[model samples]
Target: MVFQCQRDSWARQFATRVVSCRAAELRPEGGGEPVRGFQPDDRGLIGDVPVLRVTRRGPEAVHFVQAALEPGAEVLLSLDWERRFDHMQQHSGQHLITAIAEQMFGFKTTSWELGRQRSVIELDTPSMTAEQVEALERSVNEKIRERVPVMVRELAADDPEIETVRSRGLPDDHAGPVRVVDIEGIDSNMCCGTHVSNLSDLQVIKLLGTEKGKKNKINLVFLAGNRVLKSVEQSHSTEKALTSLLKNGPGEHVEAVKRLQSSVKLLQKNNLNLLRDIAVLIARDFKSKPVQSQLFVLHRKEGDSEFMNIIANEIGTETRRALVILEQDPSLCPQETLLFLTVGDEKEAGLFLLAGPVEAVENLGPRVAELLGGKGAGKRGRFQGKATKMSRRGEVQALLQEFVSHGSPEA
Candidate 1:
C-alpha cells in the first residue's frame, strides 16, 4: 500500500506562530556522530530520528518519518503529549466500565467525554444514587483483577471470526485487518487510542464523582493508578490524624470519633453562653459613652458571628437614628475567614465610618485592610475579606481614636 498524507491536526489545536528554524543534514543509521557537516537532503529528521519526508505544516514541522530498521515507515510523534494518558485511560476504561455496568446494573456505558483534565463515562441508567456509584466502582476494580490480556488483532474484511467479535462497531474505510481489542470474554471494541496491554495495568480506578444527564445519563469522573495512589496517601494521612484526635487505638477509632462529636456539641453550647455575656457587657459600655455619631466597629480575632451581631445590636440599640458595623464572628474562631460585616443606609453612614481601620472610616477601607496586613476590594461604600492577622482590642481602640479625631474620610 502507498503512503497517503493524512490531515495534520496540530495546526487547528494551537494558534501558534513559530519562526523558521534551519535544518542540518540527515544522518544515515550507522554513524554515531552528528554527521559533522550539513547534507542537502539532510533534514531535521536524520541526526537522532531519521526521516522519510519532512512536511512543513503550519507552525510545527511534522516529520513523516520511519524507524531506521526494516518496515521503518511513517508514524506520528509529537512533543506535546501532556495529559493524553488521562484521555486514553478514560476512553479505555469507558469500554471496560460500560461492559461491566451493563452486567451489574443492567445499564450500558452509552457515551463518554474526554475532558482536558478528567474523563467521563456516561451510563444509560437513570437516577443513579451515590451508593450505586460506589458499587459500580467496586465491581469495575474487581474485573480488572482478572488480569485478562487486552489483545489487539487486525483481521481481513471477509474474516468470519468478525461475527464472533465483541466489537461495538466497525472503523471507517475498512480495507485492511480490523483492529479489535478484546478483554478475553469481557469487552471488545474498535478504537484508535492506545490502551494498557492488560486490565492489571489499571491498578486502581477511582470514581471521583458523577453528574446527571438527559434520560438519566450518569456521567462519572475517575482517577487511575498513580492518581489513585496519591489520593490514597492523602486519605491515610487524614485518618492517621483523626485516630490521634480520637485518643483511641485504630480498633476503637469509630467510638472515639463519636465521643469527640458529643464533646464538640457541648462546647458549642458553652461558647454561645459566653458570647451572650460578652455582648451584654460591651452593650453597657456603649450606653455609658456620650454619643457624637453612631459607632460601628469591626474587630478581627476578637470573637464569633454571634458576638459581633450582639455587640452591633447593643451599640445601635440606644442611638437616636440607629446604625452599626457589627461584623459576624466564626462559631469557632471569630477572626477566622468568613463573610463578617454589616452595611447600613448612608443616613447612618457615620455608623459605616465607625469601621475605621476596623472600618472606622468609609473611604479608608484599603488602608484599614493594609494596617491589618491583608488584601481586599470594595465599591458602593461596602468592603470585606480576610486580614493576614486579626486586630487586637488595643489596636482596634487606637483606630477608633483616629476616626474620632478626623471627621469624614477623604474619598
Candidate 2:
C-alpha cells in the first residue's frame, strides 16, 4: 500500500531519502507476534526490494501499515487475498490506462498515489479536454480485451539499458540491471506493484473521476474488473426502470425515456393543481365542522410530503381544535392508517400515546417519539413526540382518556 515519492522535501537523493529495513517496510511484520506458517521468503518479492502484501479495511483500502522506508527494511503483511487483488487491479489498470493515454494524448505519467479505494496517476501535461478522457477510456478497455501477456523480468542492477525503461518507480541502485514489466509491444515500465496475469484478467477499467493539479498533473481515479461490472449492472437496472416508467416499447426505449421525461413536467403541473384543490376542499370541510372536537388523519402511500402538510394545515388551522396527523411512513401497519387527535380550548389535557412494543409501531410512525420518549407537552389534548419506550402505549392511552374525561388540565 506504500510507495516511494520523489516529490517529498525530506531528501532529493533517492538512496539518501530511503533506507531499507525489511522488518520496517511491511506493517504486519512490525508487531512482536510471529506469523503462523509464514516462510522467511514469503514477504514480498524474491529479493531485497520489498513488496509487503496489502491489508484491506474496506473493499478498497489498505490500513495500519506505515509506508516510510527504513534501514534494512523489513515488510509487514496481511494475509488477505482481496488486498492483493486490489493491487493487481490498480497496478494492471495503471499500465493499460497510462499506455493508452501516452499514445493518444502525448502525455507521460509522472507520478501516482496508490490509495486504498482508488488509485490516481499524475500526467506530465494537463488541459486534455473531456473528450480525450472518454476516448482513452474506450481504448484502454479494448487493450484489456486483447488479453496480452504481462511479464515481469528482472535484470542485474548494473545494466546500462535500465535507464531506457519508462518507469514510475526507479530504485537508487545503478549497480544491477533493473526490474521491468513488459506489456508485450504496448508498454515497458519499471514498477514494483502487483499486476494481473494478463490484460484480459484486469477486466473493466472505469474512470470514476479526475482532478487537475499543479504543473499539469491530472489525477485520474478509476476502478477495474468487478467494480466496473457492479457499476454497470446498477446503471442498467436504473435504466430499465426509467424505460418502463416512460411507457415506451422496448424497441424504442431511448425515445420512450425522452418522451416520458418531457411528459413528466406537464404531469407534475396537473398533479399539483389536483392536490391544491383537494387541500381546499379539505380545509372547507374542517372549517364547517365543530372546531372544538375534530380529529382528522390523512395519509398518502406514495410518499407525497406536501400532501401530508396540506391536509394537516387545513384541519388544524380551520377547526382550531382539530388534531390532524399525516404520515408517509406507516411503520409496519397498514398503509392507510394515520393517527390524529383534537380537543377544545378547555385545555383538557389529552395524550396521543403510540406507546406499544417497538414491533407494534415499527411501521406505525415517527410517533414512537411521543409514546416512548416523553418528548412533548401541550395545553389542550395535543401532545406529540420524542418516541422512546415502545411498551405500554395502550395502557398510557387508556389512562389519558380517563384524565381527559375528568377534565384534567394536563396528562
Candidate 3:
C-alpha cells in the first residue's frame, strides 16, 4: 500500500489505512470520574495522525478516533500546519520558561493552558515580583538564542531514565513506554502535546503580564512568535486611529480625550438649565388661556415624553387643571406617538373612593390605548402609554374631546 503526503503553505493532508474499528468513550478534562449513558464510534489506524474534532459525552468520557473505513480502507487526513506550528512554538516556549523559573528561583508551576491568542501558566505561589518576571523572560530568550536541540525518547516505565525525568504523574491507564521530551541543557518533561524540535523554533516569547488566580496562584500571561507579531500590529493600528481622531500626537491622545469629555459635561449642564426655563414658559402660556373645561388636549412636536410630562406637571400645579398631552404625528403607522393624561383633584377619604380619579384620565386611557395598539396605567390622576401607530393620534384626540364636551365621567 502506498501512502501519499500532500503539502501546502497552510496545511498538510495525507492518506492512511484503518487497522481496526470499534466503539470508544471520550473523557472530560478535570473530571475525576467517567460519565454514563454516552458512547461514540471509533476506528483504529496503523499510522499516526493529529486529532482536530471531538465527540463529547454527557459530562465525562474518553477520546477515540473516528473514521469511515474497513480493515484496509484508505483514509484522508487534513492537518492545519499553521495552527500546529503556532501551538508548537507556544508549547516549547512554555517548557523553557517553566524549567528556567523552577531551576533559578524554585517557583513551581501548578498548571498551564494554551489559549488561542495567548497562553497562561499558573505559578504555585501567592504572587510574583516584577524583577522575577523580567529575569525569567531574559533566561528563556537566552536558551532560544543558543539554538538548543530538542530530543524525544521513549523508555519503559521501569527504565533508569524514567527516574531522572520530570513528570506531572502518569494516568492510571498508561501501560506502555513513557515519552520524554528533553530540551538540551534546559529541561526535560513528559508531555503528550506536540512541540517544536528545537529551542530556536520558538522564535521568541514575550511576557504580557500577570494576574491573581484561584487558590493564590499567579497566572503569567504571554504570547509566542506569530501571536506577538499580531498583537503589535493591532496596537499600532489602534494608536494611529486614536491620533487621527484626536488631532494630536500619540503621546497626547489621552489628554485630548480628557479635554473633550470636560467640554461635553459643561454643555450638558447648560442645556439642562435651558430646558427648565422652557418648561416654566410653557406652563405660563397654558395657564393664560381661559379654557376651563374638565379636559385639556395639547399636542407637541419637540421634546420626549419625559420632558413633556415635566411641562404637563408644571401646568397642573400652576393652573390646577385637568390635561391630556400627546405627540402630533406628521406620518402614519410605525412612528412612535406618546400619550399622557393628568387631572387636578383633591384626595377623597373613606375606602369606597376611587384611586387617582380623573374623569377624562381614567376613561380615555384604555380607549386611547386601543387606538394606539398599546396599554396604559396611572396613579394620583396621571396616565401614560406609547403607541407605534402614529396615524391614530387624531382618533385619540377626538375621543377625548367628545368626553370633555359632556363634562363628567358618566357622560
lDDT of 3: 0.63
lDDT-based ranking, best first? Answer: 3, 2, 1
Alpha-carbon TM-score of each model against the true structure: 0.53, 0.47, 0.61
lDDT of 1: 0.54
Report the number of the highest-lDDT candidate.
Answer: 3
How do the residues 272-377 of candidate 1 rate in per-residue lDDT, one tens digit apiece? 7986897778667756765433334444333554565565555445432222222233332211111123222212121111221234334556655655555566
The TM-score obtained by model 1 is 0.53
Each model's lDDT comes to 0.54, 0.54, 0.63
Judging by TM-score, tell me the better candidate of 2 and 3: 3
Question: Candidate 1, which ten residues in sequence have the lowest lDDT sum?
Answer: 1-10
lDDT of 3 by residue, 130-188 (tens): 99999989888888889999876777778887778888987765555677888988888
Better of 1 and 2 by TM-score: 1
> Highest TM-score: which candidate?
3
- RMSD of every candidate to native, in Å, equals 13.0, 13.4, 11.3
Query: How many clashes does each candidate structure show, in the order listed?
Result: 13, 45, 5
